[model samples]
Target: MVKPKDPSENPTTTTNNNKMFIGIVWNCVPELKLLLSALLFFCSLITLFQFFPSHLSFSIQDLRQCSPFPPPSSPPPLQIQHPQLQTDNNNNNNIIQQNGVIKRNFNTYGSAAYNFILMSAYRGGLNTFAVIGLSSKPLHVFGKPTYLCEWVPDSTGNGSGSVTVSGTKILPDWGYGRVYTVVVINCTFPSPVGIDGSHGGRLVLHASTSGGGDANFNLTDTIDVLEEKNGLLNSASNELAEFNKPPKYDYLYCGSPLYGNLSPQRVREWIAYHVKMFGERSHFVIYDAGGVHSEVMEVLRPWVERGYVTVQDIREQERFDGYYHNQFLVVNDCLHRYRFMTKWMFFFDVDEFIFVPKKSTIKSVMDSLEEFTQFTIEQRTISNKLCYLDDHPGKIYRKWGIEKLVYRDMMKGIRRDRKYAIQPRNVFATGVHMSENTIGKTTHKTEGKIMYYHYHGTISERREPCRQFVNTTEMKVGGKPYVVDTTMREAAGAVKRFELRMIGSALLKTRQ
Candidate 1:
């Protein structure tokens, strides 16, 4: 440290210091001092590079790898063309994607409400349409929206001239909420319209919802491939033909299936009581709507085997109109089923038993009416003078007289205000309670001796139509306590006898 710099070896440092001192002396002169300072700064920079060349020199690859930002890129191409599709002619229904759209193939599918779709299938002939409702937003928002359709089997099949697509906009039916904007797509399948198995294929539907989006909606779930109504009805007609074959009976009681909390005990009692009371003159046609127990069916097996009762399985066909209206359809179907077979058809529920005082049996009442002048019989349709035979206001068996547990505690029954028996062929259509139109113009109120002994107290516990009736019905004489109609002596007697048979060892053994 003491031997610092040798005067002889450090001559350069001394020279540089002398030069800076000379420049400072000249700084009194403005331009000359500025120029000398610039020269000195440039020399300093050169000296720095000479000492640290490693820090300054770098390659392009090294700079790129060390950089924090990403490299630039170009956008992907637009996808307009659909992919290859695979079709099957034998398959009932198949789903696939083709030409950037989803394709569906089906043999049979019918009109059904879509849970997510507001529009009705709106199918006619070979063409299927989406009847848009209130909730559908504008298709234009997704670019140029169009419903593209094509024929089945042939992958390249375009729509035939008969099959055309329309962008027609219309309002939906009422009850679908207020209309804002709606559009319908006329989705047309291949040729051979109105035939179920003609094409055995379905029209593929694909629609663009956005400017650059793929076909977003597949309408196969919404569209219904329609077939000839008669073709659809053929099997049912055949079944009806067998069911309605003319029987040697004067009266027939028709009703929908026995469902709900109706136990075997009650069903047995009802059937036995009717069979005993009506003798061999009456027959029953019970439609099994749903939920009928095997035990109940077993009890009626013997009677059914004897041809005295017929149980048509209503579940065999699809119920399109829901419970009540389907019930109406079934009841109407019954009228047509036995139109020519039974002279007097009685439409009543199983809980109801028609009571006749003077004429004990239905056959007696019908026979008595034969010579009467109220209605005259004619070929095809009946003479237009007479109407249906109405019962006098009837009483409901409000409570069980014996206090038996079999007669469950209910509000009891009430008077059946209005219900009547009609000639099936004479009536054009039948509803839940009354006929829509009869061959005759006037409906004459018959003598009041006949009454309906309704044991409908336990109706609240039953399923569907029975419960629906009680729930919706505004009773005329409600809030009254249970009152047994003492005049129903025959029904009272039948109850006891049936209870004995039900609890007795004999019927129980037969059940086993």
Candidate 2:
């Protein structure tokens, strides 16, 4: 009844109510927006914690343990520790210890028995391809292995391509009855594959028997394709045009694996004398087969610092039961490793010394025989025990082995194994004595051209080598004839002066 009497008054009251409600909402606008924003931020934080809890609560170690992917399977990169004798202190003892443990573990379980050592790929020619590796002798007992070349994309936006080719296992007959051998997997591509260094590809070698089902024996890690100078090609011309030209190096020495208790003084003398003989444009690649101890490293550190030597820690090679400190394997690896870098590569032992007669220099001898791809130097065996009867014992004992021990072993008609040098680019697989597989000719008639003095059993002898003194006229000792050969002794003074000039007085220090 009241609504019926005041219709107009009701309208005015409704209008006032509407105005008050709108004013209240306008006054509380900022607070409502703040509340909404706070709720949204809370929800966002909850979502972030749910999805990525490790961001706030995990450490690097924890994250590593929580990773879903498996660890890498490839063997750790070979550690080439340059001899930094100056900065090596007691603090490095801990580092050395760690390295010893690592080497032990690597030898124990780095690669399988069938896996390859020092694996690399190369383009032999436009149609011919090769992947060189050092593996067990039984690798080809079943049959030849299969090779797969996976090529990367070119600059023209072409996709990566792959080709599977049948391989021929070319094993050099120089394993010396050892377990490991050099396996050159020769693959003949139907068409020239784009797996050259210009395209940057990888190689996968599969170990398949005649019976098959041996895919698991495949090399787990892929070997990168290596070209001459790592594909330094002429952009204006075809890649094949520059492929034949190998990088130049005057001289390169691939030393045998150093093992056992090596004499520091002997090593020092060998390195110094060779450095003098090889001249400035020479490099020495030495492998440490558990023999490059701290004392030996100290002797070699200066030469390493001067960039004349490279010491590779191949102590892991001992883990494998290979031939004679893996000499064949190492030399083959070194051959392919430095194939492009060096023009002529020498294969010899530290106990031996390469000598050219005074009338002709090493350059002239090598130049004269440049037409031949490989040449074997005659081994003039030197006595390790015989000494001059007239020389003073104390003075002679202090001299270098080559200088003090001047007696040459006259073992006539004895066919001693010869050390040889090669044009590495032309050589496929090398050995301690020579390479059986080469693209060019090999000559063993290097009598007057070049020769080496083999001081057998002298490198490891720590004590004085003057076991017996013989008169200059005396010709025989212990059923073997000996003669005083002063060729190396006459040059000792010059070598000593050279060592002093290059390494200062450090070489004069007595070995502990």
Tell me the whole-model lDDT of each prediction, alpha carbons only.
0.46, 0.72
TM-score each candidate. Answer: 0.43, 0.70
Off by over 4 Å in 1: 1-247, 318-321, 358-417, 441-447, 457-482, 494-512
lDDT of model 1, residue 234: 24
RMSD, every candidate, angstroms? 17.2, 24.4
lDDT score, residue 474, model 2?
52
Give one digit per residue, the lDDT tens place, for model 2 in 217-237.
Answer: 444445555534435333345
TM-score of 1: 0.43
Regions of model 2 farther than 4 Å from truth = 1-130, 142-160, 173-177, 187-199, 212-235, 240-248
Tens-digit lDDT track for model 1 on 1-512? 48677876788988988999998877768886787787666555544443344556454335435544433443655666544545555554444454444665534455222222332333323333333322223233333544444323322223233233433432221222221222334454443332332223344344433332235433422333222233321232323232355656667777755555455544655676677666666788988766355766776777787778888776643323234424544565566556667767776666655656643655666565653322221111111111111222132222231122111112434333455567665654455556645665434344554555555533323322111112111222234322223344436566557546544433443221
